[model samples]
Target: MARRSYKTELGCIACEDLSLLGAGKEGWLVDNPNILCAIDTHSVALANRSTILVLGWSDSDGSRLKIRPELSPIEAEYVSAIEWLVFDEIRVIVAGTSCGYMLIYSLRGDLIHKQMVYPGRVIKLRIHGTKKDLIQDTLSGELCVVTPGAIARFDGSDIQNMLLKWFEETHAHFWGLKPKRQGSEDFGNSHEKLPYQLWNVSKYGNCADAAITGIMPPPLIEVQSSQRYYCAVAIGDDAVISAFRLSEDKSRSLVGTILSKVVPATFSTISSLSKMIWRSEQTSPKKPDQKPQSFARAAPLTCLKDHPRKGEKLTLSPSGTLAAITDSLGRILLLDTKALVVVRLWKGYRDASCLFMEMLVNKDIASSSSKYYEPSKSDYCLCLAIHAPRKGIIEIWQMRTGPRLRTIPCAKGSKMLQPSHPFGASMSSSPYVPLEVFLLNGDSGQISVLNRTLDT
Candidate 1:
């Protein structure tokens, strides 16, 4: 998909109350006012009416809305976090906590499956695109290509060898495993050869019985698969943003090793990643006749947003150009993905603890003849919104200029919304809203949405 670079208004159709806040990728418009808020991403689910208390959108047309889901029943309330996974059109997985149980529900409100994943209260729950056939079957079978057996069959030893090669090529300190050393010959030798053993469990079965028996035990085959497929890992207090891979081949392996982290700025939470752009830089040679030396930039720039409670998450734009980050103080930072430098920062009034941040790019903004404009770029025209905690105080800022663009006050007669504890914001390149702000409501489990109107 092409990168977006313009901003437009999104109209709001409905609002809903949620006990706790969460974000999804898909957009939604509900017909019921009691429903209050609706968001659609990989999956579509609604927060119970009583639990959700606030809703807000960045665009006047309501393209993006934030909803906070109510907490589970006290007996089932061990779920400390909730997350969504949109696998294709029909399969949306809502993974949340139910005390000791890690519940996985479908978008259709059916209990598909549940597992006892963790021992203590479930702090966070993240479900990335799965490699399981069942999960793939829901997403149009594309994910089936990622099965361990399939990866082993297609990539063979080349995948392992590539990772080994990458480790060697990127780092100068190979712990005496350099090609110049004789011992280095065995470095990737195991990867080059597949080590699998097949055994016939019923090899000695009675011949007469085997012929009479309608069913016979099949041979047991064990594929000694390499462990190179551990490409993605989730890190944080609750593993909010779990990383996964889309490819297994060596040439594309680095791309598959994306680090996905969660942004906790807004209730409409999302994950982002950073891509490593590798280029060779030549150094001056000692002598004119000597060849210039080249060096590899091993560390790619990383982008992460602040978490509601602690830590941060990282995300990559669809076009891989901009990296967004949110800080614990409800501050949003945008970075050049390739250069790994901060290009812009957006801060709201008061700290935006547990608020969400999104990017809305207006194509018209790029086409405009403004000296600060560039049409060919994506994610240039960005808009940010937050569900403010204080009454009559919603802050919105332009990322490029770092200027406060608008501030929307809370509705009249509404109680001031305040965060139970101070936290930070997160940023991303989704083009939905540059930032979705939120304020936690003490231990009451309520959140309030603030709309910021730019002061002309």
Candidate 2:
């Protein structure tokens, strides 16, 4: 029998990488937009060095918002971190700098507030909508700020109240009304524990000799009526992904008082690492003494946190059910947040960056010709755009599985790298579409376009 080969297509080339200007200088090309919320438009917010740029997928004039001038004095403090926040009343962007300052901005590029969040660099930041603490001013979750030594949790109600006032004062009145009853959507309100608020704060990482790189709030989880909990994930200087359980109700936790869990010591289980994360916390504990009690992804694969080459960056699904980790070894590990396992692994990518793009998984459903006619939203698929910079190519892989749907070259014969800007790392709330990204024949693959359609 002949060996089967998979064909990868040419998707649109989004932008060029200037950061990769010199030999061994691949780190400069790290431009990622931390997506916040999607309503009328999708928000793509990220930092290039100390500069912060915000782009709306709906922006028609190519006008992007710049936070450097508004925030100012880059020489003193450069932007080291950024995040997006949403409330019932307003949407804003949150940023942190090397000098330990946190900046808040309105969606329209207005500087709402700039305050020193930390004394040192603010490494990781996240805000929640649910009440994570028993004593909170607002129902908005909590604002989680991570530094090199400790993680700070602040009351989210302050930001919510601030945004509420901003909306009423601006006269824009754009804070959309939330669903009266929660979790009414046919697909279930997966984002139930959003609009983060505050109740507690914890500091870690110093002992691990790790600088926190990323932190994420748990997906919506209801433990009791009107009482919810979150199991946050954090990864840093090491290959270990640490999980923390946060709740306002103060109910007994499945992982209560438990510390460290050991995992398997072999291969083949690489795909199951993420599944273990979402499992019941009451699983049997390891023997009295062993290696660090590890939280495996699926099962056998275990956590990638301390695996020699720890993950450097993380991207999550819009629904908060999945996580994509780009490790030091140029390997992208797709994780299932719900199952807490490594669903898939795609290797051989060099200096690669990834973005979650939309895909129309079922084209036939649109025509309504078959009995299996499904809703468009049901057919909606989340795809990974693995930007392989050195090879001038972008590989599109389906999530929860390692299926190479398309391979897009930056230039013909995959010449020089075609720098691509990250499309909204988060999916749009609007209808879905399947587009093709292509690299031009000339221009060293510096240019690319998203075609209206893709060839089957």
Candidate 3:
């Protein structure tokens, strides 16, 4: 009966939904809104390669205006990722291309600095320490670019200064005067002129997941930051989520191992969530007389066993304490990044893009856990949002354990774009900030913003 069963049509579910945001441009929109950041909720900038669109809301009355700007001259380059960066009081939109290029643009869409960081395709671009999360171990404007071959880290100090120099150069070019020196074109296609330090993750192959955090090192490193420790979790084609103590000197961070990242099969989801209980049947444990690795070398104390299903993407928790890995088999492994263990497993979600939304855990929900003899915490919840486009729904799960917290059905829109989280700056502004998740319908390019919060 279970095998024969099928999901209910999402269009039939007459439940509460999000507000309509906007429609795509006559089907020319390739993907969803690549919102780097929003000056405000209504004012957002979306860029994909040569195309750039900025939306703003009028201050006097709440009305939205869509602004499209020509961000780049070259039309052939493919945009892999877009990021909004604010460092040293310098704000810009960074566009990473598939052809191994990073193009920095001003707020007004002027190309500021373009450089070639990786030789291969830039798969993921994470600009750490944005305007919202300003006080990070990372310098004001550093970024991490993940390519299939390697993961590269770029410094922000030079880029911020170069932005100023570009303004000067633009002034020089305008008055029919030439700049003093024809600068070197060692990295980009002659136009890019930024002096940023780039570091490669020489330890992994085809990195799939990565995130920067201030998590405490697991007694492995000799040196630690007094204010906030800099570290990151990285997983590559191997499916091993390796944690490292990133260096204050971003260059040396290329090396160093932190802790393990796998849960043994004996305690895995194969046992079933309802019947699953922690046992001492773990296969890999600490060896006696095991020596700690040096901070200078990149090594993980342990790499968890790979999931049977092939992993598609990795999204870390807002606190950097957990990692959610989505695999081809429609399973999401909620992993504890600190201990490198699978805390929980959620199954039956197919082709889902995950995001984190914070909300207060209510009193009634905590008391209801007693039926399972488990008590929920009341402070805050680690809500896992699984956007399953194929299913035309967003599933919300509570991470305290593998429980289906809520299921948000999609409206009937056949022209829906891909699902994505709000930009990092917006996400980090307030961990518990109430957000209206704009769910896209698969038709007509219409959007629906989730109006109500799951306060209950």
Candidate 4:
């Protein structure tokens, strides 16, 4: 007989109550509320509509850290997404609001910096970073802010430098020393605006969600240039999957285009010309003379075959070569990010959520020397974990035609989460910290972790 899979080797279960936030509570019309959550090594950020709370990973004292954003009294907005940002031994919470404002908060619940990213609602904020090799110190990272019709990218170095300056100034005040700039209280207003590259991705369809999958290599016949092009993949209702090539050349907005021809370029500078026609598109109060934002033109790339059902949620693999998308019809489509093609599909699993995970190749062996075990060659494999709510099971299946490995019975209101690794870290270091998945029980407010184990 074939050897049985080690489903029984799932190890070291733990739980923490989460009932106070009312995250799992359900009603007649609203079965699943739009609750946003992000996890780091030591803390968890949970947002239920407007209120946001941060709790210690395992604090017995039950202390809650609440972030209070400074908002205008005239307009109201709610939180849409939250993520933990780690750079240079500092950890902070980054939150996006429905009114297109990005806010950064210190762990002590003070707003560090705020910026208006877009005039429309912010859909998602994705942070992607990578290194050339394990030994090399050179690294690259970017923050992609996605909206319905456009996408913008902020360089990682830009954000890091801004945070460093703020922290240094704050420290100087603590020591009662003369600081070069204003104190932390005035820093927020006088903060410099971070320059970003914007792209109009509304060609294929309005983007429900999107990400910068990877940077494409230049073509053989291409002219030598300093600017690098990027590939952006988007998901929507009309078109299930779409992609675009983002160019560096600036594209004029409708208002900007009309005024450019009427006004002489020699008479007015680029910044002055843009501000003359740039109008406020948002309901939030703002000065009419605010600086105008610029965007680059997006060229259409290959699009996946149109599907009747719309995609609901998307998750990407660690390498970013593959993406798992769940749809309205209870099916999951796995796509090759580089090729822009669907490689695999699964049906009959409605209202499902999927996440990419890694499993050890050799499950029978045990490493007893220490807790920090260095993995050897051919040690791990990529897998997809699917949470099927109708069947009340969490299924782990091997990727690219591999067989199902485990079917775990989970609670009805549970959610699967992938822990965010520290920013600016090397991908080679991942082997030291084996990839794992977390489970949050919405009904009972309990948290649990699932780890691989040898036959006991």
lDDT of 2 by residue, 1-456 (tens): 673322232322223322222212322223233221111124345455455655443335234565553334634666666676765435677777666556677656666655544346676665434323345432334566665533455556666665565455445323445333221221121212222222222222431211111233433443334544444455555434544454444332222212221132322254246456656556557433222121112111123445566556565554456666777777777766555677787788755666566566565654455665434555656677677877777677776664877776453222211111122222332443433332322222222343222343
The digit string of per-residue lDDT tens for model 4 on 274-315 reads 666786354657454333365675667877646687867787
- Whichever of 1 and 2 has more lDDT, that candidate is 2
How does model 3 score by TM-score?
Answer: 0.60
lDDT of 2 at 40: 18
- Stretches of model 1 off by over 4 angstroms after superposition: 1-38, 41-77, 91-93, 98-102, 116-349, 353-383, 391-406, 409-456
lDDT per residue (tens digit) for residues 258-334 in model 1: 21111122212321121123333555474322111111111111323334522243333323344444444555555
C-alpha-based local distance difference test score of model 2: 0.47
RMSD value for candidate 1: 25.2
Ranking by lDDT: 4, 3, 2, 1
- Per-residue lDDT tens digits of candidate 3, residues 113-181? 666665556777765443334456233445677766445556555665666676666667668597533
**What TM-scores do the predictions have?**
0.34, 0.54, 0.60, 0.83
Give the local distance difference test score of model 3: 0.51
What would you estimate as the lDDT of candidate 4?
Answer: 0.71
Best-matching candidate per lDDT: 4
